[model samples]
Target: MAERTSFSNEEYADILFYYGAARGNAEQARREYGEIFPNRRLPDARVFSRTFRRMRERGTVVRYQGDAGRPRLEVGDDEEEILNHFQIDPTLSTRMIARRMGRSQWKVWYTLHENDLHPYHYTPVQAIEEGDPFRRMQFCRFLLNADVEDRNYLKRILWTDESKFDKDGITNYHNAHYWSVRVMGNPHLKRQKGSQRRFNLNVWMGIIHNRLIGPHFLPQNLNGVEYESFLRNVFHELMEDMPLETRQNMIFMHDGCPAHFRLAVRSWLDQHFPDRWIGRGGPIPWPARSPDITPMDFFVWGRMKSLVYATDVPVPNIEDLRNRIINAAQEIQSELTDSRVVKTGVVRRARACNRNNGGHFENEL
Candidate 1:
């Protein structure tokens, strides 16, 4: 195990004085502090600077009560009230909770842990409204009972969706954290919202078993006519690639977008897929706002987004963004699809949704 790295309150006091006396020269402060406390090695400049800055900001060199000064596990009506507040709304911040409960933030946090309560980050999900639970349950039950040729129905599913990728869409700094002696600041360049350089580009794609198809970038906004054209001009090619028997058994899956419900698109789907499809006006009513069950929404899009923006190389134009998306889609391997989509994950998700009585589940699609 590593040595205890946290400094004592006495050491913090000495460091604070030296940091000020040395006028923020971290190295000079460290050397001066070492002269006073010969037995203890001074922390690195980064740690020293962070601690010093924190002390100044908090207006104290002494540690917070629950974290460093003392471990306060004592509970009363106050602690119980804090826990109850959190139980009612888990999203309540400790600071906000402290303000409401007239208690220290640290004490409230400690009490929460004492009661085996911890704050979990909120997950982004499609908002489920009234009657969605029944729809979600029905969808899960269909998947659970679905069978084709004595095999699971998922084997024949062509899960498809459209996603928008922005040229300047950068990951959130809050979502990206550094685990070290001190928290590091984000260094990635920031882009302003609604800037011309930050324009969004849309792509349509489908996933079937171990195969990924068509990250076709839309040159214009997708409407009923464009969606119909895509189905005729692009989606047919997807069908042509598969064996005749596979095509016969396959079930097309898409969300209930306005374009998907348009008469022309519905006519085409009716003529081509007949009863073998999942969506509005088909055999199964795909649950509204439940992307957690779709491979494209939860897994494929996230994996591609992470890959597309991962590099430090600048995407100067829409073409560059398109190329990056295509490359990322190509990099999605068979084994990855086998593990994420073809395995028991999709079925397990349906079961989880069913268990929750059609309520929104934890993990994303």
Candidate 2:
């Protein structure tokens, strides 16, 4: 007897009926089939059993057509439905939308891409208060006016800020990874914990006209008194290397932190820098929560941290971390001296801020 590869719907129904009538016995069903269709060749006994089992399991002996060929890319209603899901909730992930709509994730993703949709990562920005925009606009205009007076005004201002560095340096897991053929254990980063006591160093740095001054270490908990002493003693000494004329003409800038706004600190700025300083209650009021405009905040610290923590090895101790920070600062200083990129960015940011009416402008830049 010949083995059959295909069966019509009527032929399938007859095979299932005969198998059922024979009390689920494949040999009896085959015999019955041969008797009923005397002219037709008998299908293999295994075919009868398989047909019977398929009917019992799926309520039909129809072969599955799902994997017959590659599925055509869906258009019309499917495309409209996928687009509608995104239009309703733009925050929905492709996987989530796929599950909700009973579609494959790749299909949904392809549809989005076909429509020129892209996923944009969210950027964290400082909160702007009710009166912040007005103040920001005012301050940005002040910078612009100063620039008009001197083309090199932005470069002549010393940008300063303090940042903390510790054994557990920043690690962007998104960009850090190891590729392999097989699944492996997650890589661990060692860090100091409680009882072992993690150590942190508060570092202050200044950038002015392609020159970087002191990677000065401040007390862990900086207060008004410590900040005042830093200005009175440490800051002036750091300026010794600058040309006398440049030092006289330079403008000092710091943020509106409580330590920076102290009476003694403001008084020192008034005496030393006179009207050539920008900060809280100084000659120029640096807007609160406005790190977006400062070169130290917007550029230097981020760049230095990336360089300091570029290695996979964890910093062994406070001393090691300090050395890494000093080295990173030196590298940044060399880059600064070679180009006017950072200084030029200050003027560009000032214009952008003014155009935005003092709102967040980093995104626009």
Candidate 3:
């Protein structure tokens, strides 16, 4: 006969500890047991009840050799049912499957592992409309062809976009930490509001090859007039530092945002960039809803936000927030000068988009 598997004395003590902590509730004890010892196989609710009863009546957790109880778990008995549930709904968590099947979570978990099943996170992607993919493909081909004509084509094109920075920036709870020597309430970050209104700063930035431009703060409610003023008055000044050769050869690119589609903006672009600009109705039409191909969207904004909000404390006011953004932009500018990071990424993404027929190609890259 095969030797029987049994719980160790320490395991018995832990069961009793959780049982008492849960006020003798067997189901709660089982849950607490699974949480406290995730790697161990979970005992059924009946096991908890029996263990507690034995502790009270016999004053010990050790079982006699002749004790008659439930038979050892046979995974074969429930493996098919567990796997069937997963086949029907792969999103169902182990806990949900265990509850539905009246089995311990560890049992379902073990069955999954034995069957070579593993969990994967779902990636969020942009929604491609009916014509979006075709447009994206066409633009990607244009970019690839331009690269062939001039190796420095991607490096010379200037990319620009506007993003909003909030006072209460994003927090990744998984990475956030607080250490204490004494017991206390959980520390929290305060999300401050000004007169019942959330505060945010709208700023514009541009990237050309290894150069950074214009951390210019824009009005909260941006419009065509305001956008044109920025382009005429502020944008030209920002580009003055660039080499005459680069400024002359640069192809200005912005997305199909409402402001960029205005007649005034288009006319301004036409006067300045003639047949070189990319936008809603410019010389080269930019694909709508195509952030995956834009350096400003795919790289610059995310990088700047991460740097700006990597703070030990919340930004006190708009001035401090603005300063932090400018500092972050300067830091990114210095980093870009050292490496061809943004240029390389743009070319790689354009190729990936072409390969995927422009239908969400981030995964391939």
Candidate 4:
């Protein structure tokens, strides 16, 4: 248990004000507070959160600790067993765990809370196959070495990916928020029936240096031939606008999709990019299931999606959706790409992955 410290009323107000001004993200507000008061110890995130909620409800910051006098259950053998079980499998619910342990659900819940144990939903990622880490390390080393020799090496590479967008399926799902005093629920979005098939569009795009090459909607499902066809139409166009130097030194990056490795696609890439492509059957193998280090996965697609679906106004049809995507693409600036995608994204993420031994990077919670 954290020791109870009595803070001045002024200090409490200041903390609340800082948190509100910085939005409701506790960590962000805490960071700002740290910058302002380097000498004073800021409260833990949970403490800050509880105080902020109280302020929101009462419109004032108070020093009273509501449950301070209540006796906390002592950590005994039973608590240790509960902690052990929870540590082994966080998916076990309080009620289920209590039943298993022959204890009350409230006791289990209290024990978990006292121990600072909270359940978090799993984040989805692609499953990595064997030898994926070695491939990732090798590819990152290749880029790092090339960058060491030529500073512009990263800028010369084209980052590409395909994503599906559903017009009706755009909401901040799984983004529920709960206040300390009240459960503040997300607004329900009434989804239309048969919405996904009717409204969804699969689009492909490529980013090289400052240029966003395509919001090209794949006419049908992608196959070896279709992917090759898209490349044939867009590859030359992507290269044509670049400088002679960049064009000569440029590399192409794509994931290890079967379509990408097919003979037709491989042959076309070989002709256009030669040994400068990164993927299966190419010069450098792109690691399987490694999206954290890819600019397309980590940056481009996410930014574009946020831009496209940010508006609450319903997209009328497929054409409007495509137009929205194109408009979003147009709004994407060169500086944004240069700063976010290439320098901070690819290279920085590469180094992070290498440090993690090719495992997934820890997400900022």
Candidate 5:
């Protein structure tokens, strides 16, 4: 576009020349174009000095109040508070401090961003559980423990949990990738109707040195007889058949389920090499809903679900879904165990289970 010059448009001339020239520069963009800028604080004194000197003959830009205008940046009191908090503690990232303050990470980011605190090195990367401080601490603890423990611990310690999967359904957004998309709006998604053959699928999963060990799914309607049998079957498949050395070293740690806590189950556990089975953490006993202390609650399950949801496979049946889930779990372990993954320090915050007890989640609370 050609430059147009007239007394009426003379003031607007700097609008084009200034912005066009400032496609990139050390000088900051002015908050306003004309002499209308109150107080006339130069966006960049150096830029104004250079610009005015160059346009001395052309009269393209006039030196208004001997300075250029400040850009559209506005820093409120809240923004200043965040800036001060960040400046004092260089260790706390935008998301971390945001978590502490019970606020969105982007809110903190915006605070810094408006104050021109955004930079190359201090660039904000998207973090998970960005709003919860306790979870962040939990994630940090998991990393710390993993870093200290040997690879053998992760393997020997079998992490087991019961995941109920519908015959052909999607529970959350994560379950969609593992369900049958063939039927538009899958009807099997709801709870199985009366007298229906609802698959009471129960899986026992374990990991060994970044390798998934077992996931022996229990039979349908597994009662005491079936659960006991399933346990014995799992033992036969993993522990009973393995060499004495392998069975001796392999430690199984499972979540507290009603069936798992049954006296018969405890009897079975005691009978199977007595002290070998995981205890309820000594005499005091581990409390229910303490997911904050568990490794699986934060890292493993969430990562697996994330991967499962991301998968775009045509899950035809439960068999296919199981296979897909296993694959997702494997992928999570593979990605999580990699040296690069751990080094990245992607903390998966500790979660508070009791959200109803006056709801204490954020550090601020």
Candidate 6:
């Protein structure tokens, strides 16, 4: 069993005063509280400072104020409504209420959690609209169901997701800090409308471990037949290009889009590379709406969007978008070259298997 660390409420109070909400990080918090010190000393500014900074960044504390460049969070009007609503009734969401009240969704989420009133997020929020989460989860299940030692040796697992990249695309991920005047103005008015949402780079990205194989943008006006053709072409290209050991064992994962699932496409996959081609509906079992578990979900698109969309680059047309996406992908590939994600598909699937007893994610995939 894991050894648990324990402390009394008084010790906890000392911790909060010295290290947390009491502004006691480093030099100040320790001295003022004067609690038992394991090392009988104050923590250096860097250690406590970084931990506290991460706390602030992760929204553990409402706002870090009084210091230089620190943001001051002003309490908003609708907080009581959130505490009352989510607390009293279970089904309502910060987003739902905000939509009804015509407020920024962030403001609602912030107010609830900041006040220590937020209920746990019961499910993983869907990042992709119209995406089947369980289906994506099932694909992950299939990948992990393979011989782990062999798959790990060959790095043979891959998954794909689509994105539209625009030269002027802005896909930055931001912390939702309500009460920061810098982010949102007075309660009387709303933030300016039409901050960038979508981008012009429409790409189909293929991800495997630390490697990014493609940001393959579909040819203009691609449909089901075209997509199926691209699959055949890409698989041939991918398999042949691989080292000898890897080419024989690779599993190509994709969602159940009409292009992927159409009978015509199925026939082609069944005819040519019968056993090599693995898809959502493979024998292993899969779930829809499971991007929350896929490598592409965890590693690629969100990251790329954060890089490409977060910028103020100029992309007025598809050509400009394509150029920017190309440049950005190259830059990201280079920057993330030394970075390889350790996959958790096996661990996660094992837990899911426990939950299922005998069933599997790929049962429907």
Q: Which predicted model would earn the best TM-score?
A: 3
lDDT of 1: 0.71
1-365: candidate 3 lDDT, tens digit per residue: 24333588888888888988988677788998999899998986556666776778778665543334755445867987987787776656888889988999999887775444556443345566789989998998898899899999888889998888888885444422222111112223222222112348988999988888879999977788999999889998989999998988889999888988889999999998989999999899999888879888788888998998897678899899999999999998888866887778888998888887777777556
In TM-score terms, candidate 4 sits at 0.64
Poorest 10 consecutive residues of model 3 by lDDT? 178-187
TM-score of 2: 0.65
Better model by lDDT, 1 or 4?
1
Ranking by lDDT: 3, 2, 1, 4, 6, 5
Scored by lDDT, model 5 comes in at: 0.47
Q: Write the per-residue lDDT of candidate 6 for residues 228-320, one digit (tens) a residue.
A: 888778756744555665545555566655567778776775665456555555433345544445566556766676765565756566765
> Candidate 1 or 3, higher lDDT?
3
Winner on TM-score (1 vs 6): 1
Off by over 4 Å in 1: 1-119, 170-199, 312-314, 334-340, 363-365
Instruction: Choose the strongest candidate by lDDT.
Output: 3
For model 1, residues 1-365, the per-residue Cα lDDT tens digits are 11222677777777778877888777688888888778897665555665676666777544343555545555556865875676575556778878877878888767765443434334444667899999999988888777423455787898999888886655564532211121222222222222112347878888877778788776446788989998899877866777888788888999888778888988888888888888877767788778778888667888888889997666789878888888898888544645546436678888889988998665433
lDDT of 5 by residue, 279-329 (tens): 354121333444433445445555655665564544567776687677876
In terms of lDDT, model 4 sits at: 0.70
Ranking by TM-score: 3, 2, 4, 1, 6, 5
What's the lDDT for all of these models? 0.71, 0.77, 0.78, 0.70, 0.47, 0.53
Clashes of 5: 7
Candidates in order, TM-scores: namely: 0.63, 0.65, 0.66, 0.64, 0.41, 0.52
State the displacement of the C-alpha of residue 170, model 5, in Å, after optimal TM-score superposition.
Answer: 7.1
